[model samples]
Each structure stands twice: as C-alpha cells, then as structure tokens.
Target: MNQVNVFLRQRKDHRRWVALFLALACVVAYATLDRLKYNGQALNHKQMALVCTAHGLVAHEHNDDCYDEDGELRCPLPELELHEHDDSCYEEMAALVCNELESDGHIHDASCYERVRDEEPSCGIENDTHEHSDACYGWHEELICDIPEGEGAHHHGLGCYEIQMALACGLPEITEEHVHTDDCFVEIDMTPDEVEELVEERGPRRTPSWPPCAARTRWSIPPS
Candidate 1:
C-alpha cells in the first residue's frame, strides 16, 4: 500500500481502539456503581429499578404508607398483616404501579401488572363474603351452617342466607358446626310458597317450644 494510505489506516485503527477502551471503561463504571447501590452504599438507577422490581412495582400507600424519603422509597408506617379487606388496597396499589410504569414507557411490565391486578379480587367482593359470613354466623353458629329458620326468609338456602349475612358483615369463614337452640329447625332452600307447603305438611313447631320464639317463628303465616 502507499505510505499515505498506510498512515491513514493506522490512525483509523488507533481511533477504533480508543473508542473501544472508552466503552469498556464506561461499562466498568456502570457495573461498579450498580454493585455499590445494591449493597446499600449508594442510590443509583440500577438499585432503584431492582428494588422496585422486587417490590412488584406496586406501591401500596394505604397499608404501608410507602412514600419517597430522601430520593428513596420508605414506609412511614409499619407493614401490616394483610386481612380480607386488604385485597382492595392491594389492587389499588397495583393500579397505581401499572399506571406509573405505562406512563414511563414500561409497557410490557405494566401489562403484566395489569393482568395481575385484574386476576386478583381487589374489589372487596371476595373478601366481603368471607367477613360478613363469619361475623353474623359467629353470633348464631360455630360452623358455616344454613340459617335455622327455613322459608321465613326465602331466596337463599338458610345455610346460604347465613353465609351471605356473615359475608356481608365482613366475617371470615369458620368451620364450627352451626346449630340453633330451637327444637325444630329446618334446613332447606325453597321459595316462600314452597316453604309454606313444606311447613304445612310437617306441622307447626312444638307447642310452648323450649326456645320462646320457636313456635311463632317456625309457623309460616300466609301473607295477607
């Protein structure tokens, strides 16, 4: 090759080496900084991202009161043990996290969070059943049982009625056997008319029943 061409080639090769070395130096610096931040020595993007990912990107403020403190996320309150009611709160946080991610161009990860939020019953519907069913039933029975007085309150199986009531009241489900003090308690899920037919066939509660209201409560007086 000509002398000028060779000299130019050498310069180009030198520039390429210089560029490669600079890139390597930058990578080493970034890696070192990342390591330091993760070890709690510094606050860096890598550490922040990793922490956020570990926490599922969802910042639940209701239960934990997670807030930004000195450029870092910190909880002002102590972590709470999740209860049935916390489902809604978790969903809310998940929503916030997904929204934040989406706004920041983290579309794929945000979509994953959205899916998770959607699958979780965070509307308090599932927890609603557990809580209400547990409380009202607690006053009446040990186990999750049907309401003792059948037909009086139609549409729900007496058991279903009791379960519904307990759930409405936010009581958690229990396994205690459900029993009533009344002498004659029926277990059936029938309409008002069906209940009337059943009661008429079985006869009314025993006279002067041990439970004061048993006779009056069990007798289905036809609605005028």
Candidate 2:
C-alpha cells in the first residue's frame, strides 16, 4: 500500500512539472511574436521614409502629391516630352534704325575776315613851352592840346595826342559762301550694316518656356 502511494505522488509531481514547462513555452512564444511584430512595423516605417526622401516628398506642405490620394500620401515619377521650337515662343522684334553722320550746311576756316587800324595826328614841335602856332591851328578840337583830365593823353613835341593800339584777331567769322568739311558733319550712332550683322549673330530672341513635367502627375502605392 505505501509503495502505491509513493508511485501516485511521483506521477502528480511529474504532471505539475510538465504543466509548468508548457506554460513557460507559451509565454516565450508570445513575447517573441510581439517583438517580431514591433520590428516589422519599424522596418516598414523606415522603408517608407526612404521612399519619400528619394522622390523629394519629405516636405508635405509644399508638394501637391501629399494630398492627391484619398487617405494617404503618394509619390510619382515625372513625365516628360520633347517640345519643338515655335514662333509663339519668341517675341516680336522691331526693325532696327541706324543713324549716320552728314553735313550740317556749315563750314570752318582759319582766315575769313581782315583786321583794320585807326590813327590820329599830333604837333611836330619838340618843347612843352612852345605856344600855339599854325601847326596846331585849323585842326579838330579833339586833336588840340586842351585834353581832359582822364583822356589818356601824352605830350609829343608841343602837342597832346591820344594813341590807340589794335588787338590780335581771333577765330574767323562764318561767310555766306561757306564750304562743308569733315568737322562740319554731325556725329551718328551704329550703321545699318552693323545692325544687320548683330541681328544675324544673335539669331532670334526667345521667351522662356515652362518647366518639364509641369502640367502632369502620376500615381503610386500609398506609404504606410
């Protein structure tokens, strides 16, 4: 009887040990599954971040792609097409007007007019004490010895006379029959040939075109 009781106690202890081991295994499996789930979520978020960065969609505010989707953000590649040249792309150019030098109906010279001199007469006597004689008589009142105080007079022999000098001539005056020279021509801007050459070299002026892929959009998988 005691042997049977001991056998029964041993069987109960073994069953308890088996239950504890099974419980420990279940706990470990649950914890491992939870860690794997968390890691998977983190990896998915990192991959989405990389995709957004590659497509230049990191800034959500400035991009229209961020709001095009129904409930999530989507990034798409740009579509492009080659555009040919057209006349509408260029602005209208006006015809060029060139100016040239021409004669202004005038002439220049170094000698066109002559100079003139004036003269006056005085008594031919030598001493200031000589009295009025026939040489000083019958002359103009201005040529007489009675000179004004500030009349710029000097005594020559027995007379007082005013001497005047002439000034040197300056630039010549214009005449009625003047001839045109290179100096008489008016200055001008660019010539017509020069303007034509510039136009040929520059070809045509063009207005700026719209950017590539500016009018289109595409769709892709929404980021998690």
Candidate 3:
C-alpha cells in the first residue's frame, strides 16, 4: 500500500510539472504577440489601430480622416499615430517640420532631419548657410529653391509665388516683350523638336490636358 501511494504521488508531481510548463508557454506567447503588434516596423491594421486610437484619430475625433470607403485605416496627418511604435513622428512646427526617431522605435533615438533628406536644404542648397545659389531662388518672401538632378536643377510647378526677385531669374523677363517665363513656366535649352517629344513622352499630367495637353519645355517642375 505504501509503495502504491509513492507511485501515485510521483505521478501527481509529474502532472503538476506539465501544467506549469504549459502555463509558462502561454505567458511567453502572449508577451511575444504584444511586442509584435506594437513593434513599430511595417504596420498592419491592428497595430495601426492602436496608434490611431492614442492620437484620437481613430473614430470620431478632430481629424477623423481614417478609413477610406473600403474601411482601410489611412493616417493622413503629418503626425500619424505611429509614435508609440516607431517612436518617431512627423510634426509640423510653426514654419518647420520635425520628426522623432523613437517614433520609428529605435527605442535608440534618431534625428528626423538626417533620415528624411540628404542635407539641410534639399530645396537644393548644397551648403549649411542656405544662401541663394544657382539652385535656390527667392520668390517674394518665400524661398524658391531648385531641386538638383545630376547636372541640372528643376522646379516643380507649385504656383505659389509673391514675385520678389525677377531679374535674378534671367530666363526671360516676364514683361510683354521678354516674358522671362510664364507663370509656373521654365526655360529649357533643348531644340523645339526635342522639347515637343519630351512633352509628348511626359503625357498629360506634367502638361495639363484641359488647355493645351502639352508640356512646353524640358525644365519641368514636379507635382506637389
């Protein structure tokens, strides 16, 4: 009888050990899933939901622009809800924009400026001072800088200007006789035939289809 009791007790202990192992496994799995959902890498619906919720952009908040007609979560605001996950968020200050890398979730801190662009003035200033060089231009009080390609620079046709510096842009004077360039127009050094081909190849987007359906020059600006 005593021998039988020992065997039963040993069996009970074995069962207890199994149960404890299973409980530990359950806890580990739960913790792992939580980490993945909030890791801040490539986000999915559930992960993005958590982020949007924190920012009050989830359902009926101020900027409730989430969800298209298809019920997809689209975060449109510059500072979307990824700050907790990625640990970095894109925020627009008074005149400047800033980002935090933690929102990216380095959970290591990083600089938003370094990750976003090649240098300070991607507006095309090569130096730190951001002076008006060949690539940078001034329109009214605003800076009308050129975006540099390999050899040349181009301005995307963002038609917001105050007309501060005219002579600085010596392509063609805006006067009736000269017309340095028309509104949102740029001068190309290409021959007329080449310019026509480029316009055609660019399709109707660069040049609008409403009035002319044509691009006039090689110096085309990008769309905002």
Candidate 4:
C-alpha cells in the first residue's frame, strides 16, 4: 500500500510540470509575435522617411512627419509640394507668372511687361490726340493729308496742299491777276529750300497764271 501511494504522487507531480511547460511556451510565443509586429511598423516608418528625404523634404522620426523647405507640412505625399512656390512665383516652370504677380501688385518680369504693353490701346499712330480728316492718314505721331506726291503736294503749317497754290502765293513769277489768300494755302512748317529741293528731285515746278480758286474751279469743270 505504501509503494502505490508514492507512485500516484509522482504521476501527479509530472502532470503539473507538463502544464507549467505548456503555459511558458504560450507566453514566449505571444511575446515573439508582439515583437515582430513592432519591428514591422518601425520598418514601415523608416521607409516613409527615406521616401521623404529623396524628395528634398525634412522627415521627423518621432511622428513620421514630412515638411518642405518653407516649413509647410507635406506628409504622405511630398511630390505634390515639389512644384508649389511660397511667394507665388513659379520661376522653374515655363508658365506665365503675370496674373499672380499682378494680383499681388508685385513687380513683373520681362514677359509680363511685354504683355501689358501689348494690351494698351492705340490708334495706329503714336501719341495721337487730335481728330483726323477723311483725306488724311496717320503718319508716325501726326495726321497727314493723302496728297499725290507729283501733283504739287507741299507742307504748310500742319497740313499738305497742291504745289500750284504754293507757287501762286509767292514764287518765281508773281501773277498780277492772281491774289494770295489763306483759302489758297495749307498751313505747314515747310521752308522754301525744302520745296525747291523737292521740286528738283521730282521734275520741274509748274507755274500757274490763275489764282488757286479759279484754277481749282477750271480743273474741276473743264471749259465747255
């Protein structure tokens, strides 16, 4: 009877040891799985930091945050911030920065200046302020009459007229029958020398016997 009791006690002790060993194994397995999970998360964060660094951004390890050079946060996507500018000036890109600068009232570049100049109003003539006549055309900064070149066009004050009127006023031969008047002349700033030079260059100057009015009338309705 004493031997049997000792055997039973030994069996009970072995079963207890087996249960303890199984419990220890389960605890070790749980700890190992938890450690692996932590290591995977750390590796993912490291990869994100490396990606941010490659895109010229600052990466924070504590919170895995990324920021641009201007201190603006651009986490999870640094590429989107690459083309953005802080001062609204897109110098790197080949896009027009005119609208942005104009809205902010900032100085413009060469291209923007040209765009503004092209958008200005113009009347075909530079600095033209006066009304133009039907027979005149815009010439540089002045409105000039479209008088035929060889038909005796001469400048008088700020106008152009036929050469016959100029000759009738006071030239080589003064006709007693023809009298000079403002109606027969076009106001201009032309000199006698300039008229003479023009005449020499374009054939000879024509001389008229009648006054400018009579000549105009005769030329308009030929003698029947």
What are the root-mean-square deviations of the candidates from the true structure over C-alphas?
40.3, 33.2, 35.7, 42.9
lDDT of 1: 0.34
Give the alpha carbon lDDT tens digit for every residue of 2-88 in model 1: 999999999999999999999999999999988876655322222111112122122122321232223332332222223343332
TM-score for candidate 2, residues paired by index: 0.26
Which candidate comes out best when scored by TM-score? 2
* Candidate 2 residue lDDT tens string, 1-224: 99999999999999999999999999999999999987775554321111232222111222343322243333322222233333333332222122222233323232332332223224566577976555554442232223333343322221222222222122112112222234333333434455357547866543223323311122122222
Please identify model 2 stretches exceeding 4 Å from their true place: 48-73, 76-80, 87-224
Better structure of 1 and 3 per lDDT: 3
Model 3, global lDDT: 0.36
Q: Relative to the unseen true structure, what is the C-alpha lDDT of residue 94 in candidate 2, on a scale of 0 to 100?
A: 25
Give residue 175's lDDT in candidate 1 (0 to 100).
26
User: By summed lDDT, which 10 consecutive residues of candidate 3 come out lowest?
Assistant: 172-181
Listed in order, each prediction's TM-score against the native is 0.20, 0.26, 0.21, 0.23
Best model number under lDDT: 2
User: Sorted by TM-score, highest first, which candidate order results?
Assistant: 2, 4, 3, 1
